[model samples]
Target: MTSTGAPPDWTTVDIAVPRRSDRLPGISMAGFRQRVPSPVDITMVAHPAVTLLIDLGEGDGIVYDTPGRHERGSVVIGLMPGELRAGGRVGDCLQIRLEPDVAAAALGASPELSGTIASFSDVWGRDAARVEDRLRAAASWDERFTIAADILGRRLDARSPVDPEVAHVWRQTLTSRGRARVDSLAGEVGWSRKRLWSRFGSQLGTSPKRAARLVRFDHAAHLLAAGHAAARVAAESGYVDQSHLHREVKAFTGLTPSAVAVAPWLAIDDIAWPASSPTRNPGTDSPRHRARELGAGGCHERQTAVRDHC
Candidate 1:
């Protein structure tokens, strides 16, 4: 869901989802607001397979390339729109799409092309200045979004679909209460573990279990960010205990639950929830509740950021 706060005077923003042929029939266009700052915030947006970002024209920006999964964050500057090589970060006011290649590159693999620009530098080198010039010259946010989407569409192609069974199992696992049993999911999907993994890996670019963990971690991050107690978050997120939740949090984000709970730039509320909020009975301290707790901090931070940025 998009934030509904007061709109920015100089910038107008909207999100649209193109038809997707991948794991799901649709994709989410997460919206963000850009704030003027003394020392700019370098945001990291992660998505499954590939993530996409576009510049909304609040200011001059840069994109950095970095090794997938590397510990140290890298920085790039003065990047124009187009395909970027693996291993970089973007500057303020730039819209970013974590494309499949970028996702692959981040996961330490060579990216497979889908007719999009093969390299970030190559794309940026040619059109950055022109795009920026056009954006600056344009009078409205609608125009900027239109132009940016056109450029992105030109560079990117639709993602291929995963096996239906595999997709089903994945969604089930994500929406499940706690650590999903692989065998159980396999049974429900009518596939063996090996078969499921093979199909899932080929299509989703990550293991089903890993994907579930990521989804769960995302949930936990949201709850923590939303100001929920760690113990409550652990229970709600399906952790065996708070320690288990903490361990997973550290693994995914390199921060303790408390630290993530207060992360300045993390927007827990912005992360998409399942189509329906997963069922969680009040008496049962399910993993879902734990995940919701993490969101508390993230939601608060997002609200504050939106106000400051707007």
Candidate 2:
């Protein structure tokens, strides 16, 4: 693996991604290693997928912080854990993002994990340590990715799948970038609106409307990261206006669009998760070109008031 430059103050971060043929449907994996080990901190941006963070380093691999809780080591981060921060002396780590449908089967309890973070052992039971040992002992990143895919593929095949209708709704919501109306989705699926809503929540751990908003916000965040102005991003992302965009961004990340533009978490996304669709807002540059324009670190102190998007 080659080194990718981080912000001015930090050492380079080496990123490893799976080969296209090795990638699994509904799952994305990337391995990260620090060139010069040191304490690191970053505020995580909200995304549509359920995240599995496998800590493979010794000592305090990673520490997570939410409003009133703190957790260390490998963890499962469910959809939209607002204002979450991950930091500490990370060495080598594997991050896997699971589509909600895949997560339902692979995790077996995704509905219970919504909007929260759980210990890896809590979700995988005694096998968590065993899995970590196997990953840590792997001869290379490619080996680790293969081992991870095998473990997840077996679990996914063993469990019941999500409702076809619910899965369809989710796919449509994302394709539309959160502009798909709930009633229209229900109609297309031939299910009553209430039925769709109930099933979606029970199976996906989040309502359809909330999922759409999250997806929409994620798209806008990437646009902002790519150097698009807030007004333009809002217009492209289906927001009522720039103010609407600001509120949603603040709600999800506790930061304004301008702040999110330089968020370190998003800087490595194009490198770590290369399969994401390129940002193609009209008249705007693609995110891949501006991905590393981000500043060093993330929001360390929690800000209470909303700031100007600027």
Best candidate (score: lDDT): 2
The lDDT, on a scale of 0 to 1, for candidate 2 is: 0.77
Let me know the TM-score candidate 2 reaches against the reference structure. 0.87
Off by over 4 Å in 1: 1-25, 30-37, 41-49, 56-60, 65-139, 143-160, 267-310
**Candidate-wise lDDT, in order:** 0.44, 0.77
Task: Enumerate clash totals for all models, in the order shown.
Answer: 57, 0
Off by over 4 Å in 2: 1-8, 280-310
lDDT of 1: 0.44
RMSD of each: 10.2, 7.3
